[model samples]
Target: MSEIRRFAAEARGGTPENDNRRVKDSVKRLQATVVEFNYLRSDGGRVWESSPLLSTCRIDERSGSLQYNFPSGLRERLVEQALYSMISLRVQWEFDSKYGLVLYETLKRYADRDAAQPWWSVKTSELRDLLGCRDKLTDWKDFRRRALDPALEEIDRLAEFCVLVIETRQGRGRGGGQVVAVTFQIERKPKEVAAATIRELEKPKVQRRGERKAKAEDIASTVDARKALHFLTGADAGTRLKWVKRAEAMGIELPKTASVVENLARWVPQIAAALVAEERIR
Candidate 1:
């Protein structure tokens, strides 16, 4: 029973009789939350298990797009449903720390790359933009009321614990219950605070310039000189060798040039041949 029925019963002119049904209905709102959760667990499980290469699921706010970043192929299976879920959720509230991590982990399993990176580490400015509205709900009750309509049609807002329920003449079967109740919480972070907090969510770290230089050198060492020659030749073979020693050290097998004019004369054919071979030019 809702507090409304209890209040009406105690009042002098109150008609508690009709309140009986209203109270019963209100309680079911809480129950729907549980039902939605089960549905999500079941359906979400299927998506994850079936589509391993699909990762990086996001609910876009501006255009209300549910973008999925998958390795390949897997997205085609779920893209339509993913879009449906995104539309259903209405995404009234932004994802927070706990909920964000859950989504990140869930989607990461389907991603091609390492899913171990924390949600905060994903560096998606677009997501942050979506989350910008977190602190904007001034009227919680009004907001909840408006949100309830879509929740039933769309998604499971675990953080809010809300569901849209529809009453039925018989039992609440499929297509019987309209969206009715929900369990959702609203965050009231101030604009300044939310902005500051989100910024710290992805702070850039500084490293020594020398360290960066060394890392670059290390990366350079792994270059395949023969492969580079192949590419250069295909590109036109006329490209000048800026660093003769470095090219030679890279095993490019190119002659060191003391004179630019002489180097260009010889370099063009070498580059053109490499290009031809790359293209399998007979």
Candidate 2:
């Protein structure tokens, strides 16, 4: 009950401190909450168990303080995972307008890159509620244009990571197809904190998993090379060679000036020109 109350508070945009505090007060008020479990026991017997999900809860009405305890390590882990789908860079509130902010927070929850995939799939209804979308609630195309696309643009431009969103439809014929889900991929850029490093998310509407992974690898290599290339272009010729030698000694496969100049991706707009001007082109 307390956990549900905390979610309700969070959905209504309460501060984290308040969210935690409310759980305690709310839990104490609930008559009882039940927890059910089914698992193998240590003695080689399968057992089913049921207990109060909130076994212990206390509240100090005057101080407005509260206390609650979790049931088990696994239960705690489940709660943590449910609460934090993703760890994100602290985003500036105003950088994203209301729609943009909603979208960013929603996607940030699914920003788990270490997973088998780098994307999230959210049902259309759930996505709408999550974004607090009350106006034009039935219009899919308009929602995508007014809310989704602009939000994507803002998050990509303002945040450290960029994302792309696409939608799928359900049903058929007669009443027209309803949108089923919205899927998108999040890609992290270079570590340098600059707007220039933000890359556009331009994969096609229907990208295969393998292709998505290939693009990810390609983007990663270019980002790495861009870092090295940026340093080399800004340094004196002597320093550039010294850096290259040190990098080689460290067993790093760097972009030779020629390779960087000739084959660099378009995202690194400055590097190739700098190399060409310096007569470093192969």
Q: Best candidate per TM-score, number?
A: 2
lDDT against true structure, model 1: 0.37
The 10-residue segment with the lowest total lDDT in model 1: 118-127
Superposed model 2: Cα runs more than 4 Å off:
1-82, 85-90, 172-176, 190-282
Residue 243 of model 1 has an lDDT of: 34
TM-score of 1: 0.18
| Cα distance off (Å), candidate 1, residue 206 | 9.4
TM value for model 2? 0.38
RMSD of each: 24.8, 18.4
Worst 10 residues of 2 by lDDT: 197-206
Instruction: For model 1, state the Cα shift of residue 27 in Å.
Output: 50
- Give lDDT for model 2: 0.60
